[model samples]
Target: MTTNNVRGHRRRLPAIVATVIATALTLTACGGGSDAASDDDAATAGAADDGSFPVTIEHAFGETTLEEVPERVVTLGWSTHDIVAALGVVPVGVPETWGGDDEGYSEWFRDQVEDEIGGALPEILNYDDSGELDFEQVLALAPDVIIAPVWGVDEVSYDRLSEIAPTVAHLDPENSWSSTWQDLTVMVGEVLGRSDAAGELVAQTETLLDDATQAHPEFAGASFVYGLTLSDGATELGLYIPDDPRVRLLRELGFVDTPAMQTVLDSVEGGNWYGGVSLEELDTVEADLFLAWSAGPEELAYTLEHPTFSRWAPIASGHYLFFEDEALAMATNGPSPLSIEWALANGFVDKLADALAGGAVTVS
Candidate 1:
């Protein structure tokens, strides 16, 4: 936890609700107009220019070079699918999103592929909640390259995947799952041979974030803590590190994480980056703003009624933000260009601004 005064994040969205498109994507959208053709083109396109081939890239595990631009890309881990799809290339396979649609896919990703690519949903890779990879299922996809550069694929997993295709694991062991969206976009773009396009994407995303802070100056002074809160008898608080994408996202929007919370995180000892604190220590970690992630409305409601939870300053001052939507949570957990748009479009900035302005707890 380098503690550069970072803060909180979470995103949950309803299903993509376009007039006809909404009804059409019941479970899968296979029979369609330009959508089918769009997917076909996106699925088979080469990632890089001819001159960009044989490019060597390094990661936590090792380096991989693509002798030729990859036509089939298989993405394992969060956010990779959207990054690839946003670049006008559809992955042949994708990881299971945390709170995706019934198809077990992120709404932003599903809609983008349907509306932009005009294609059927990509194959859902065998990725479980535990981040385990289904080696056999991944192998059947027969991808030209495997992208997991921002995921937590260990040595064994990397070694296995590398055997099938040139696999790119997490960029560093020290900061697992802490890869910035820019790094993820650029790396995936490089692997696909779309470095220029990737650069454009990063610029666009940065501009989007700049526009957000510019729109809401009130967010600048507030401090926040991003944590997951469950209402079960045992209520544990999962305090995400400052560098975690969720926390970094809030920092991007112009808020800072509290120093008190940083001390609590620093005391935590583990290879994994998050710290575990009891709800009893809520007051010990001070922040002008507090963001708590809940599984749903029911959970959020239950958490608010906890013995000590209700008395926390943020909660008492009504300066806290409770995230109850699963899709919205996933979007903020590790934002990509597409997911960030979804968060903004769905009032992420507005809620934070409301929190800074202060009146009642902002629950979304």
Candidate 2:
């Protein structure tokens, strides 16, 4: 059995009364009626044809049935907005992205919205300083449906969001954030009544990855360990499990998991996507290539100089890559069709090639 470790990662929210009051005030100040109607029209105009109405979707929180094709949609998690927008539906509200561009949106998402979809950008539902989701903002949007297939939505939050609209939680009841990009795309397509389009998108993405693999034979069977060192003074290393999206993406690119990863998985006792290993035992988690992200240059330097970590095989042989660009890291962490295409168009593939060649490399 696995435990729900979400509370440790996310902050508890404020009381409902305060959230309601804030929602009312914010709506009143923004002339909610007219603005909402206009946004709704824009979103509806761009949406794909209505699928069979009254569709029922089973999720972590029982089941939710959509009586009709939804117009105004709200998304709460990393790739849901991207998938929705890619399927030709503009979301009315989307959770703020941490490594996003200046507008709290990913570059690919913005490009798709502005250049391809030609619609107004969705409102960003920002978390508070304490990492609390802005429930007030979500309520103010008055979305017809809420998509959160890979979010950390607990029972209380699910019930509350259901009161606002038909809310869909994560796919797995036992794991909060374990959905794959393909599954998410297909699910969102089903919700939007565009399964055919979703399938095509998936096929195209697969072809893109396949072509990359064929082009770079070196990636095939290349053992790797993807992880990160927290800013907590580099005391421990966080290794992503096989089920994690980041690791899945690497596998799709033709990389193989190191034998050490199975040992880490055996040690992990819960549904948590990551497991920790002390810096002292870093050498035990061996791999041909070590890919990771750092808080900054200082942290990277500290990790490289650490007594135990410095002696790790990959680091000693310079077969390691670190990313300082949060945007790139986010793209890889939860890849969508849009982000994958953008990443390839950028220099992500080339960077991997460089890392495989050997030498300490960092992408800033």
* Tens-digit lDDT track of model 1 for 280-318: 877787888878677766777677777788788877777
- Tens digits of lDDT, candidate 2, 29-94: 553222233534435222233334568888987988988667788998789998887766679899
Whose lDDT is greatest here? Answer: 2
- Clash totals, every prediction: 13, 0
What's the CA error at residue 356 for candidate 1, in Å? 2.7
Off by over 4 Å in 1: 1-47, 127-132, 359-364
The global C-alpha lDDT for each of the candidates, from Candidate 1 onward, is 0.72, 0.75
TM-score of each: 0.84, 0.86
Candidate 2 accuracy as TM-score: 0.86
Candidate 1 local distance difference test against the native: 0.72
- Give candidate 2's error at residue 190 in angstroms: 0.8
